[model samples]
Target: MRRNGNSDRLSPIRVYEWMPVEALNTLLKQLEKEKRSLENQVKYSALRLEQESKDYHKTSRERCTYLAERSQVSGSYQVSKRQQMDQLPRMKENLVKTGRCNSVNQKTMNAMRGPVKKISRSNHLPKLNL
Candidate 1:
């Protein structure tokens, strides 16, 4: 009995049985090769991602340390007396009259112009004749 052209309606089992055994084996080998190749690509990408993540973390840590050191260097200079001040201009003026605000800068003249005392031992201690 000759069937009409309806090969697309064949069942999966019928389709496999219709193909030659050597053709099926060749297809299987090709599919396995593709699977191995894909697996190797996946491994390569994973390793690369891990290496990049490590580098990112290391750079982040180094950046944080560098910023901290820089802040320490700049913070060493006292810009203000404290976090807050209790008095206004009136109190500040009184403090200046009492010689309390001598450390604060209100004049344009240099503060380091004060006389520099000699650092020799004679100025520190009384000269005792041995």
Candidate 2:
């Protein structure tokens, strides 16, 4: 690769030629510890994701079942409503042909109830002249 003119500006200036072995060993140990911690964190995150996926699937199934049951109930209600609508005209026609709405029930109810007695005002108070 050809060096760009800006590479000189980005490059770090060398202060020392080599690093000490003790310092290098300590740095390696720190990197190893960091690697182990990062690996543990990744494993924990993976398990959490798996649990969440399972819960999502279970909840999805339950929701689908609930929706299906709701649809079935609504469908039955709609069918019953349609049947009632279909029967309404026939019921009205029957009522008209039979002449059943001609106030006969009211007359019968009045006959069954008979008559009520009237109260007399002359029995309680006598005639007085002023």
Candidate 3:
């Protein structure tokens, strides 16, 4: 046999008559306390999320700054290296002109060797019989 839904369900007045006032009051207070606790948890969770977002953004900015500085340093080093490489041919030409790699120039050789002193030669008269 199918049960009647209306007969199975208790009306508000019947429920109130069955449950004592003290029990209903206690249940209401417990529910209110739980609601307040849940609200506080929600607020704490929101604040924690906001703080984590701020920390994430701060670290991201710091990382970007570090990468930019590293790239600039690397770029500067590359430029300096390129400049030195570009001067290679000119340095070779200078070496060739200075005769350091080929026949040496007397002036340049003398300047590189420092000052030279000349010794005076004096002949003393000595007769030897052959």
Error of 2 at 69 (Å): 0.6
Sorting all predicted structures by TM-score, with the top scorer first, yields: 2, 3, 1
lDDT of 1 by residue, 1-130 (tens): 7665675467566977889999999989999999999999999999999999999999999999999998887676443433235446668789888967753353434357754343567677878999
Q: Name the regions of candidate 2 deviating beyond 4 angstroms.
A: 1-17, 97-130
TM-scores for candidates 1 onward, in order: 0.49, 0.58, 0.58
- Candidate 1 minimal-lDDT segment of 10 residues: 77-86
lDDT for each of the candidates? Answer: 0.77, 0.80, 0.83
Task: State the lDDT of candidate 3 residue by residue for 1-130, as single tens digits.
Answer: 8668885685655776789899989989999999999999999999999999999999999999999999999999999999999998899789878867543444344666764444455445566799
Give the TM-score (vs. native) of candidate 2. Answer: 0.58
Tens-digit lDDT track for model 2 on 35-105? 99999999999999999999999999999999999999999999999999999988977876796753545
Q: Residue 66 deviation, candidate 3, in Å?
A: 2.0
Residue 129 Cα positional deviation in candidate 3, in Å, after optimal superposition: 43
Deviation (Å) of 62 in candidate 2 = 1.1
Q: Which of candidates 1 and 3 reaches a greater lDDT?
A: 3
* Clash-forming residue pairs, model 2: none
Q: What is the C-alpha RMSD of each candidate to the true structure, in Å?
A: 11.5, 9.9, 12.1
